[model samples]
Target: CVNCGKLKADLNDTSFADKVKHARDPKTRMSVVWNYCKTKTICETDAIEETDPDMPDEAAPVKKGHGGCGHVQPQIRKEGLKLFLQYKKT
Candidate 1:
Protein backbone atom coordinates (compact mmCIF):
# COMPACT_ATOMS: atom_id res chain seq x y z
CA CYS A 1 0.00 0.00 0.00
CA VAL A 2 2.71 2.44 0.97
CA ASN A 3 4.72 1.44 -2.06
CA CYS A 4 1.74 2.13 -4.25
CA GLY A 5 1.77 5.71 -3.09
CA LYS A 6 5.42 6.07 -3.88
CA LEU A 7 4.80 4.94 -7.43
CA LYS A 8 1.88 7.28 -7.94
CA ALA A 9 3.72 10.22 -6.42
CA ASP A 10 6.75 9.45 -8.57
CA LEU A 11 8.84 9.72 -5.45
CA ASN A 12 11.51 7.55 -6.99
CA ASP A 13 11.60 9.83 -10.03
CA THR A 14 11.92 6.72 -12.20
CA SER A 15 9.70 5.06 -14.70
CA PHE A 16 7.66 2.21 -13.23
CA ALA A 17 7.73 0.37 -16.54
CA ASP A 18 11.51 0.41 -16.61
CA LYS A 19 11.76 -0.83 -13.04
CA VAL A 20 9.43 -3.77 -13.60
CA LYS A 21 11.37 -5.10 -16.58
CA HIS A 22 14.48 -5.24 -14.40
CA ALA A 23 12.98 -7.43 -11.67
CA ARG A 24 14.16 -11.05 -11.37
CA ASP A 25 12.47 -14.14 -10.00
CA PRO A 26 14.01 -15.83 -6.99
CA LYS A 27 13.48 -19.34 -8.37
CA THR A 28 12.28 -18.92 -11.96
CA ARG A 29 15.28 -16.79 -12.88
CA MET A 30 13.02 -14.01 -14.15
CA SER A 31 9.72 -15.51 -15.24
CA VAL A 32 7.11 -13.62 -13.30
CA VAL A 33 5.09 -10.54 -14.04
CA TRP A 34 3.92 -8.51 -11.07
CA ASN A 35 0.59 -6.93 -11.82
CA TYR A 36 0.45 -3.43 -10.44
CA CYS A 37 -2.81 -1.48 -10.91
CA LYS A 38 -4.15 -4.24 -13.07
CA THR A 39 -1.19 -3.66 -15.33
CA LYS A 40 1.40 -6.35 -15.80
CA THR A 41 4.32 -4.36 -14.40
CA ILE A 42 7.80 -5.52 -13.51
CA CYS A 43 8.64 -5.85 -9.84
CA GLU A 44 11.13 -3.75 -7.93
CA THR A 45 12.86 -3.76 -4.52
CA ASP A 46 12.13 -1.72 -1.45
CA ALA A 47 15.56 -0.18 -1.50
CA ILE A 48 15.88 2.35 -4.33
CA GLU A 49 19.33 1.49 -5.63
CA GLU A 50 20.77 2.63 -8.97
CA THR A 51 18.46 0.08 -10.54
CA ASP A 52 15.71 0.44 -7.98
CA PRO A 53 13.31 3.21 -7.08
CA ASP A 54 13.30 5.81 -4.28
CA MET A 55 10.83 3.99 -2.09
CA PRO A 56 10.26 4.45 1.61
CA ASP A 57 13.32 5.01 3.78
CA GLU A 58 12.56 1.86 5.83
CA ALA A 59 11.00 -0.54 3.37
CA ALA A 60 10.78 -4.28 3.95
CA PRO A 61 12.12 -7.05 1.75
CA VAL A 62 9.68 -7.75 -1.06
CA LYS A 63 8.24 -11.23 -0.87
CA LYS A 64 9.13 -13.40 -3.86
CA GLY A 65 6.39 -14.35 -6.40
CA HIS A 66 3.89 -12.06 -4.73
CA GLY A 67 4.04 -9.66 -7.69
CA GLY A 68 3.42 -6.65 -5.55
CA CYS A 69 6.46 -5.92 -3.45
CA GLY A 70 8.92 -6.01 -6.37
CA HIS A 71 8.79 -9.42 -7.95
CA VAL A 72 9.67 -8.80 -11.61
CA GLN A 73 9.83 -11.18 -14.58
CA PRO A 74 12.95 -12.41 -16.38
CA GLN A 75 11.91 -11.29 -19.84
CA ILE A 76 11.08 -7.88 -18.49
CA ARG A 77 14.53 -7.59 -17.00
CA LYS A 78 16.17 -8.40 -20.29
CA GLU A 79 13.93 -6.08 -22.24
CA GLY A 80 14.45 -3.27 -19.78
CA LEU A 81 18.20 -3.52 -19.94
CA LYS A 82 18.10 -3.62 -23.72
CA LEU A 83 15.96 -0.54 -23.92
CA PHE A 84 18.11 1.22 -21.39
CA LEU A 85 21.25 0.54 -23.37
CA GLN A 86 19.58 1.62 -26.57
CA TYR A 87 18.50 4.86 -24.97
CA LYS A 88 22.01 5.46 -23.73
CA LYS A 89 23.37 4.98 -27.22
CA THR A 90 21.28 7.86 -28.44
Candidate 2:
Protein backbone atom coordinates (compact mmCIF):
# COMPACT_ATOMS: atom_id res chain seq x y z
CA CYS A 1 0.00 0.00 0.00
CA VAL A 2 2.03 2.88 -1.30
CA ASN A 3 -0.57 5.39 -0.19
CA CYS A 4 -0.48 3.95 3.30
CA GLY A 5 3.27 4.47 3.55
CA LYS A 6 2.92 7.99 2.22
CA LEU A 7 0.15 8.79 4.65
CA LYS A 8 2.09 7.42 7.60
CA ALA A 9 5.28 9.25 6.70
CA ASP A 10 3.36 12.43 6.01
CA LEU A 11 1.49 12.25 9.28
CA ASN A 12 4.67 11.47 11.18
CA ASP A 13 6.38 14.42 9.59
CA THR A 14 3.52 16.71 10.45
CA SER A 15 3.57 15.62 14.11
CA PHE A 16 0.11 14.06 13.85
CA ALA A 17 1.22 11.22 16.08
CA ASP A 18 -2.26 10.82 17.50
CA LYS A 19 -3.97 10.34 14.13
CA VAL A 20 -1.18 8.04 13.08
CA LYS A 21 -1.45 6.11 16.31
CA HIS A 22 -5.20 5.77 15.99
CA ALA A 23 -4.89 4.84 12.34
CA ARG A 24 -2.28 2.22 13.16
CA ASP A 25 -4.11 0.63 16.06
CA PRO A 26 -5.99 -2.51 15.08
CA LYS A 27 -9.27 -1.44 16.67
CA THR A 28 -9.46 2.15 15.44
CA ARG A 29 -7.75 1.70 12.08
CA MET A 30 -10.82 -0.07 10.79
CA SER A 31 -12.25 3.39 10.40
CA VAL A 32 -10.10 3.58 7.30
CA VAL A 33 -12.73 1.38 5.73
CA TRP A 34 -14.97 4.40 5.54
CA ASN A 35 -12.30 6.41 3.79
CA TYR A 36 -11.49 3.69 1.28
CA CYS A 37 -15.13 3.07 0.49
CA LYS A 38 -15.95 6.73 0.30
CA THR A 39 -13.16 7.16 -2.24
CA LYS A 40 -14.48 4.44 -4.54
CA THR A 41 -18.21 4.96 -4.09
CA ILE A 42 -20.66 7.76 -4.61
CA CYS A 43 -23.84 8.55 -2.72
CA GLU A 44 -26.98 9.79 -4.42
CA THR A 45 -29.83 11.54 -2.64
CA ASP A 46 -33.04 13.30 -3.54
CA ALA A 47 -32.89 16.90 -4.71
CA ILE A 48 -34.37 18.22 -1.48
CA GLU A 49 -31.92 16.27 0.67
CA GLU A 50 -29.05 17.37 -1.51
CA THR A 51 -30.19 20.98 -1.33
CA ASP A 52 -29.92 21.06 2.44
CA PRO A 53 -28.57 18.26 4.61
CA ASP A 54 -29.33 20.01 7.92
CA MET A 55 -25.99 21.81 7.71
CA PRO A 56 -24.38 23.65 4.82
CA ASP A 57 -21.72 21.77 2.89
CA GLU A 58 -19.46 24.74 3.16
CA ALA A 59 -18.09 26.23 6.35
CA ALA A 60 -20.22 29.15 7.38
CA PRO A 61 -18.63 32.49 8.08
CA VAL A 62 -17.20 33.00 11.59
CA LYS A 63 -19.75 35.59 12.60
CA LYS A 64 -21.12 35.81 16.12
CA GLY A 65 -24.52 37.29 15.24
CA HIS A 66 -25.36 34.57 12.70
CA GLY A 67 -24.44 31.66 14.98
CA GLY A 68 -22.06 30.37 12.39
CA CYS A 69 -19.34 27.73 12.84
CA GLY A 70 -18.99 28.56 16.49
CA HIS A 71 -18.02 27.10 19.86
CA VAL A 72 -20.53 24.31 19.47
CA GLN A 73 -18.31 22.69 16.87
CA PRO A 74 -15.07 23.31 18.74
CA GLN A 75 -13.24 23.32 15.45
CA ILE A 76 -10.41 20.86 14.97
CA ARG A 77 -8.76 23.56 12.95
CA LYS A 78 -5.18 22.72 13.94
CA GLU A 79 -5.53 19.10 12.92
CA GLY A 80 -6.56 20.09 9.39
CA LEU A 81 -3.93 22.79 9.25
CA LYS A 82 -1.22 20.31 10.16
CA LEU A 83 -2.37 17.83 7.53
CA PHE A 84 -2.56 20.60 4.94
CA LEU A 85 0.91 21.77 5.76
CA GLN A 86 2.22 18.23 5.46
CA TYR A 87 0.49 17.78 2.10
CA LYS A 88 1.95 21.04 0.83
CA LYS A 89 5.38 20.11 2.11
CA THR A 90 5.27 16.81 0.31
- Stretches of candidate 2 exceeding 4 Å from the true structure: 1-9, 13-16, 22-25, 32-90
Candidate 2 residue-wise lDDT, 1-90, digit = tens: 222221211222233345546586776655654343333211221122234466675754432221112111111226644732112211
Residue pairs clashing, model 1 = 20-42, 21-76, 21-77, 30-74, 43-72, 44-70
What TM-score does candidate 2 reach? 0.19
Taking all chains together, each candidate's TM-score versus the true structure is 0.16, 0.19
> After best superposition, candidate 1 residue 53: deviation in angstroms?
21
lDDT of 1 by residue, 1-90 (tens): 233432321224346545554666554322332333334334444444342456664574553332245533322225644732111111
User: Residue 89 error for model 1, in Å?
Assistant: 26
Best by TM-score: 2
Q: Count steric clashes of candidate 2.
A: 0
Query: Which lDDT values do the candidates have, in the order given?
Result: 0.38, 0.33
lDDT of 1: 0.38
